[model samples]
Target: MTVKQLSMPDLVDACVQLDIGHVGLWREPVRAYGLEATAKLVRDAGLTVTTLCRGGFLTAIDPAERAGALADNRRAIDEAATLGTDTLVLVSGGLPPGSKDLRGARERIADALAELGPYAERHGVRLAIEPLHPMYAADRCVVSTLTQALDLAERFPAHQVGVTVDTYHLWWDDQAPPQIARAGAAGRIHIFQLADWTTPLPEGVLDGRGQIGDGSIDMREWKGYVEAAGYTGPIEVELFNEGLWARDGREVLAETARRFVRHVIA
Candidate 1:
């Protein structure tokens, strides 16, 4: 009953060999292996895609770019549906470059999502708003807390909107546990994402998420709260560390699975 860390077939095959329980994937992984090929390999290899790690970032300075972002999100939603994945984790894009008004950027994000609600419903995918770290407020996400995500999700109904809880961004917030509980009570706990925080953050820290157990987060305690609130879904590992990415992808995934099972999962 522990969380699993899986990637595409090569990484997933490595994870399965180590007995990792589930995997989180992205569009590029599909593109690299081709969706059908990746899916079939996952089936034959006995791996499950716990969640899809992204499908947001509709931020732009002009109407045309905004339109393009929205269109891209729609395609991402459809891709999630096509893959038979249940949760579409959203990394809501932050303020447009050179934009000083955070609120204005948030409004644009909301409006774009409002427009996409109906389309997402038809695709049978729920848009999980994942608030990024406060550090990312300027360059990555304005939605930086679970409370904010829940509030925004309230604007749209359950059929269209939900909340994503990612430890990398939320683990330090005092309000995080209660927010996790609230998301569960409201049936909006659409996805549970995992990562640890490390020192010496990178220059472009959007990819700063740490591998499990390599940093300071206590996921066991974090998981206790979510489980207490009756959350019943796979715990997805989403490390974005440059070092891990620099290594062999298979070795990285395998070690991620090992740490996830030994430290984060029981």
Candidate 2:
């Protein structure tokens, strides 16, 4: 949660100095710290950049805006390549202002991918489409379900485009297990993230993610499902909780590791 007041140097120090092994990076912080420097830092620390936070916002209605998103995503792909991570998480932008054309927005995402997919392939990067909770369908991600993500991902080469499985977003869906298996079978499961689901979602519902096992999500079950789907990559513990953010970053990192083992692994 570097976006929640933590600096990149501190975040990197916490991971490397603390022997955390891996980290997921956001674009802004990477840019702010100088992308090459940050990449060198991580590499020198022997840390793995499991996935870059995001790339796609390809759901705009205006042709010009959509083009801009593509350009931005292209830059994101280049940055990811520089960071030495192949997976670039994609939070496809939500509906255009005052627009209810969900279908149109999704279609735009498909179209944009058609253009960016080849570019990503050339750079040896994969765009992992993250299906945010349906709650964000109108404002954050038009792709609301794993099935929908797969639907779009299947349209492109598996290596160039794929789907992200984040417990925080897909834990409540009844079809998640099957969809995960499907993604794995297709070789389209790019990254796996962990964040528990909790009540009293914060305003805008963006930063209320629960620490692992602190809420209702059955993380062990999902972990099993994900592993069963042949996903053996790093399981990123990504929490967006205000309380956690308000605490010492080291403490939060420690607790996240403990919970990940106790709830997600043990």
TM-score leader = 2
Winning model by lDDT:
2
Q: What C-alpha lDDT does candidate 1 achieve relative to the native structure?
A: 0.78
lDDT (Cα, tens digit) per residue for candidate 2, span 1-266: 63246687778777776678988988888998899998998898888999998888787877798778889999999999999999999999898998999998999899999999999999989999999999988888999999999999999999989999999999889998999999999999899998888887789788878888878899999889989999988888888877887888887887788878898777
Clashing pairs in 2: none
Q: Relative to the true structure, how large is the alpha-carbon lDDT of every model?
A: 0.78, 0.88
Off by over 4 Å in 2: 2-4
Per-candidate RMSD vs. true structure? Answer: 3.1, 1.2
lDDT of 2 at 214: 77
For 3-28, candidate 1 gives per-residue lDDT tens digits of 12334545766767778757677777
Model 2: how far is 168 from its true place, Å? 0.8
